[model samples]
Target: MDLEAFRSLPEWPMILRDSWETNAGWWQAGFTEGSDVEYEEQIKPIVRVGLGGAHRILDLGGGDGQLARVLAADGASTVVLDSSAAQLQTAHHRGSSVVLATGAALPFRDGSFDGVLICLVLEHVVELDEVLAEVARVLEPGGRFLLMLNHPILQTPGSGFIDDVDLGEQYWRLGPYLREDIQMEEVDAQIFVPFVHRPLSRYLNGASARGLMLVRMEEPPPPPGFVARAEEYLQVQEYPRLLVLHFERRP
Candidate 1:
């Protein structure tokens, strides 16, 4: 379906969830274990460092329990939560404590977890403020919330690498960074995934308003594996593709 057609649907969120349900198998095959280079090399290490020393952790929207497994291996009690039952089933079979739930309404008590991590999931969620509030509510005082995102400015719909033959130079071109909108990303033939784009200020301000203070932020360049996948990417190797934010719950 085209973007205009999708925008006309009243239950876009449900449609998005159904799309994920249908693509769960494909995602499990592609991203499970160490298959995705970006996840294994850059995202995982940053999350490990940001949420270190936290015993009770919640991996919100942690599909297939990849990150949760890593935390569990480090001896932290980790719970993997996702709205897709098919994804949670794979995680459960892989020995992760799985919960079928949405981020906006977590199935837990206030201050239930010492650490919460959401990686590459927020872009799909429509209720950003509600999710952030729930994240703050479930995190205990001084708890850390590790958030990972495809860099907003770089991943915008129209953003991409540009090769200028006339100028004999190659650079990255950014999309409408300030425009906040949801669009359908065609991941495979006949399969589409919805992605919501919001500026950096929205995330920072939303978290801060919900009593979550930013402790640290990291913008990591493309990993070696990512750069090696394409020759043109080498030209923009210094540009970061991932944005990791570490926030703490205020006491």
Candidate 2:
């Protein structure tokens, strides 16, 4: 489902900004709540094999800079970049040295960053090619791109977010992994988050063509704490709540 059709009008940056500021805490909670935890435990060990503490990193669409601040605090020369002033302000307030910029048009010289992380953001942008091309241009030779996305197969248009569908094998169901070529519908929410549904393949092929070599692809399972903390159906053992991809620029 490509949601751009449901939107009679486009909310370029303003709506995007408001969506986060209004739910500013949600954005902040991601670091404490989402992949940053997995990144440290599961994703980072795989990613750090080729990179180092001295590497300069660029975090794209880095809303509120939870991971960015962590990376910066970890001795990496980290730059968190986003288009919103308020988000940038929040990131700065949260201890991120953010530059006001959009992913489609990165504000940096070629091959500037050693690695780039586009966490949970590719689903929202209309101009993915532009942003990726920009990422390719800015990443140093052999640079890495780490992307995380909400699984589109299990969650689609019009039909509300399916919490967890049963795979019917273990204690937890590993599903809602129905791959469909469904239509795009942008439902109204408290926040207007424009999303486009793409088969997971689209991301890999796109990155492959853009000079990024696919190094890793893994679906992160829910943490054991997920059941104790919040109740979501099935524990989503297989729904692919997160995808960690490590790609390096082609020399």
Candidate 3:
């Protein structure tokens, strides 16, 4: 539990609130942008298989409840918990039951949820240890925890898609993989989104310490048509972009 080195960002909460509040519309619009290819071909297949037997599910940081609505339609009693009020409003508009809450402090009783889905959210969270601990606290014994992250290796600091004409290939340049830092990725001319670059060991060890047993994991490539969109997508196909992990709360 010695997290003295990886301290949480003091300004992250305010930054997150401001970013989402100002760019809620833009976030919602791109929520399901790659639904046809990314979700259907890669992510949803794993989710569909992993969540097969679960009943009660919590979509932690389920912005705009796009994935929450899909989980509900599949017969799971689903609830979306997000920190952004504007995102919650968008989720409500989509008929999803939404709660405005951060993952670090979940207002739920122990063993309340039979399953949890945390997709692409941890990168933005500054309080990584707190959130993972809360995820363990809210899950029932043997409950499934399906997590999706931007692949740590592929999305590390100082990494980018490069179309090398001299090398006659498209590839990704990656380095400084172990350095943990806060990064601001540009979303629009006036907006930038914050993400924390954490190593794989941090995520795995943190959850393992809390008794979440990893049962399944995948580093899936982008679907073929993804390469058609841009030359950057070609590099994504070559390297892993998404890390899908399915863990079970130990009894």
Predicted structure with the largest TM-score when compared to the true one: 1
lDDT of 3 by residue, 59-152 (tens): 9998878777677778898999999999898888888888898899999999999999998889877788899899999999999999999999
Q: Which stretches of candidate 3 lie over 4 Å from their true place?
A: 1-10, 33-36, 163-170
TM-score of 2: 0.76
Give the Å shift of residue 147 in candidate 2. 1.3
Off by over 4 Å in 2: 1-18, 29-54, 159-189, 230-232
Q: How do all models score by TM-score?
A: 0.93, 0.76, 0.90
What local lDDT does model 3 show for residue 81? 95
Candidate 1 lDDT, tens digit per residue, 1-251? 33345557798868878978998988988777788898888778887888888999999999899999888888899999999999999999999999998999999999999999999999888788999999999999999999999889787866666879999887888878887777777777877788888899999999999999998998888999889988888876888788899899999
lDDT on C-alpha atoms for all candidate structures? 0.88, 0.66, 0.81
> Which numbered prediction scores highest in lDDT against the true structure?
1
lDDT of 3 at 98: 87
Each model's backbone clash number: 0, 0, 0
By TM-score, the better pick of 2 and 3 is 3
Candidates 1 and 2, the one with greater TM-score: 1
